[model samples]
Target chain A: MTYWDQEKECMARDNLEKLQLRRLKETVFRSYAFVPAYRAKMDAAGIKPDDVNTLGDLQKLPFTTKQEMRDNYPFGLFAVPMSEVVRIHASSGTTGKPSVVGYTRKDVDTWADLMARALVSAGADKRSVIQVAYGYGLFTGGLGAHYGAERLGASVIPASGGNTQRQILLMQDFGSTHLACTPSYALFIAEVMHDMGIDPAGLKLKAGIFGAEPWSEQMRTEIENKLYIKAYDIYGLSEIMGPGVAIECPFRTGLHIAEDNFLVEIIDPVTEEVLPEGSLGELVITTLTKEAIPMIRYRTRDMTTLSNGECPCGRTHVRMQKVLGRSDDMLIVRGVNVFPSAIETVLLGIPGVEPHYMIILERQDNLDIMEVQVEVSEDIFSDEVRKLEDLHKRIAKELESNLLISVKVRLVEPKSIPRSEGKAVRVKDNRKI
Target chain B: MAKQISVFLENSSGRLAHVTRVLGDAGINIRALSIADTSDFGILRLIVNDPDHAYKILKDAGFTVSETEVIAVRMPDSPGGLADVLDQISEENINIEYLYAFLGFAGGDALVIFKVEDIKKAREVFEKKNINYVEAQDLYKL
Candidate 1:
């Protein structure tokens, strides 16, 4: 229950806001002065560094987006000289170009501290043995957790993802107390553990910090029960920092942002207007203390809400609920908005069905069709065809009821869908658009 | 009690050809084959020369395969010949899950394959009615 930095974590609201305003002014000034991209963006918007005296002036500043990062390409948006930049990480864009992010030495330290705060908020301490299964390199997950665990003075096992059996062997041999990885990988680890005839309760594991992909309460319960550990949600993006932007404390209510380092805002994605607190909208963040690449009002595209309520854990930062889904990931089928995560929540709630699924959207005779290919258990597949068809109809009916859009459901054999060690790709849009 | 190999396949181009290529390369002959398809996927039912070998080869080739028991009845090639057998089975209250036909000769009696809910009951009914059922080895020879 020990705080990593009690003074900064539990700072008074008035003091914290004053600090945020000061950091915001400095960040805006630095971005306008150094980086040409932000400079032009602000200049076009008729904004000056001196104009940002109050925190509300942030809305007047231009917002940086992922497309802007791509247009800038590698190192185009970095504010500092290459010499001062200590490290660089790029997201796996998988489409065109990766969005590169640079970090100075001081920036790295700030990132580690925020991650450390995140780990401690989830109940990890100096004595905790952390197994960082998140993939290292280019991706921020592995290295991010690694630095944070070291900052927390914990013994870190940089497992670096994949090789589940070996991971389990290490988890058992090293008596690891904490796990860091995507929630899907945690379930995979549990699956391998059962195959190895290893009981989860026999392990010294207690808490799991899972993120990097959207997961549901049903999945959290599944991971907790399977691994016999308390699963905590951690949130971050490579564009901002890494795995420590915000995280859920033991209260398990919402993720607490590192308000001192990063300023968070919610905005209507379509209108691009800032929304009131407690309203779900696209997440927008401005790096308050970032030195290498000062992101001025970067649009995160993650849909969520901000609640400034005082947490039972005593942190003064506003808490963001678990992200509902990314606005970019929303699929408009037959003019009806649907999210793959929403379908996942429904599919996971049903019995005899695996959590693996793929949503295929296609155009047929000018009509939009969505097919949900879900993988059921082997037992279900082996059942009578009538029973299998019954399961299929049941899933489709449930989905139509929840999504308000009829969808075709196909029951495929177990393992028919491809599995990923990282974020699961949920949608395949075959429309020419 | 004749064994039939059933494979799950998506209704995509060259999918059935892929399954056939695997079995043909394994030196297994398809004695009789029928495909039941839905809008999305298809089930390829095959009475092969070696059911176990065909199942292994199809499965090893990453196809969803299972061996099922189906009765192959020898019937007259006349129009009512197949109908008579189906009518007798239906009268005995046994449901036919699926059925397919093969030529006994160029223009002679036909070999009809039937997958029923209860293979044992179907056999009892066939025996009581003196319906000639093809054995797995004998059918392979044919």
Candidate 2:
């Protein structure tokens, strides 16, 4: 019922946009002056700091992508000197090189307040026992939630992650009312509790702030039903002030983006064109007050729809739907942008073709070749060779027309494609470039 | 009503050999076999001693397989044997999708497996035309 920063959270649209304009100008000026990488990019785009006259001028600035962050690497993008920056965090870099980010002392304070605001919105207060279980160390989740809990005057429990049985025991004995963890880990803890024959009703857990991974509403219901606690979806990336970028309030509608700190924009992932409100697209955020890393229009690649409708909870900050998918998987083949999901949609519509497929990209004679390997399932099988060949040709033609790139369709043996445990690797890029 | 076993195989090497090995492991003897192929894939159709068992084993081995009712006609092992059968089938207006030879000459008689559009009509035509076809039990014995 109460907001951590009521004035900023419930500001009028004009006032919020005014504040955003001011912060955007300051952030652009600072990045242009201090960060060489950003200055060059802005200069290349033929834009100056004063070119940003209004909030709408954000579209004119050059977009920053993960590749840009990767290029910057350790301290190349830092706006402040190392001495002024207090803490540093690096992503696990599960794909390539780990991206590192630094936080100035004041940036750290701003992050803590943002996280605190997020926690309070998700029904945590000073009297609550907040268990931060989103991992510690270089991962921003654990310390991010921990510092926020401390700032809220809540009893802090730095449980980190893993050790499911121990997490349950602490929850039971310590009387923790609020939990901050990844949604999957929260379910694991519930499973361990069920196996131990412990009743969730006996514990005092009220809600869980779950993030770091995209989850479905069904999983939220499963966690809520099994753990007997309300589950909230929190979203953030290590590149963008960690776990406090946005969080779902008790209203359970959408995660309210902390617009005061981070300016949010939804853009078409293909054209990189800004989409109108409520249209589903990629989320691009610009860090407004982050002095250590004043990211100017950093493309988050996260796909979500935005809503500017007034929330019943009275938080006037812009709200983003739970992340739908990642545009990071968007592939550019022969000057044509293709989404595997679009191809998948086409695959499902065609009869006799299974939805299971893998997109393989290889460079041939300096041209990008995309080959889709589809399983020859029994449904599409025939004793006549020409029929099966027709099936192959049809699939290839369909993919080519839908993706606007020539595709070679190969039918492999049933269940021959290598499958992974979670989030199956749909695309394999063998290009040496 | 003999049953023909059809297995889908990819163009990748060793896929055909792997399927043969699986059938061999199951001790399923191939009475007759034929392959219809394209550059991308092939459908290996076979008349085996036990078609149901072949279908099960090939499916268990993760190969896409299917079964269709086919008639194996036994005639004298001569130059005109297949021609005579083809003439009779053409007179009956039965469109044969495909046909393949048996593994070996069975007692001076040859067997040819035919996949037709209509099984019941083809079998009825064979009966009226006095064409002697190998029974399902007799094929299993061979």
- TM-scores, each model vs. reference: 0.80, 0.64
Sorted into a CAPRI-style docking class, model 1 comes out as: incorrect
What is model 2's DockQ versus the real complex?
0.57
lDDT of 2 at B48: 88
What's the lDDT for residue B9 in model 2? 83
Give one digit per residue, the lDDT tens place, for model 1 in A237-313: 99999899999988889998989888989999999999999999999999999899888888998999999998888
Which candidate number maximizes DockQ? 2
**CA lDDT scores, all candidates in order:** 0.88, 0.86
* i-RMSD per candidate, Å: 3.2, 1.0
For residues A1-433, write the lDDT of model 2, one tens digit per residue: 7999999999999998899899999999999999999889989999999999998899999998888878988889999989998999998775788889999989889989999999999999999999888889898999999999999999999998878788888998999999888776776677568658899999999999998866666667768987899999999988988998999999989999999889989999889999999998999999999989888888888888999998999999889988765777668889787777666656656676654578899998999998888887678888877677778788888888887888988888866776432234568899888
DockQ agreement of candidate 1 with the native complex: 0.14
Worst 10 residues of 1 chain B by lDDT: B101-110
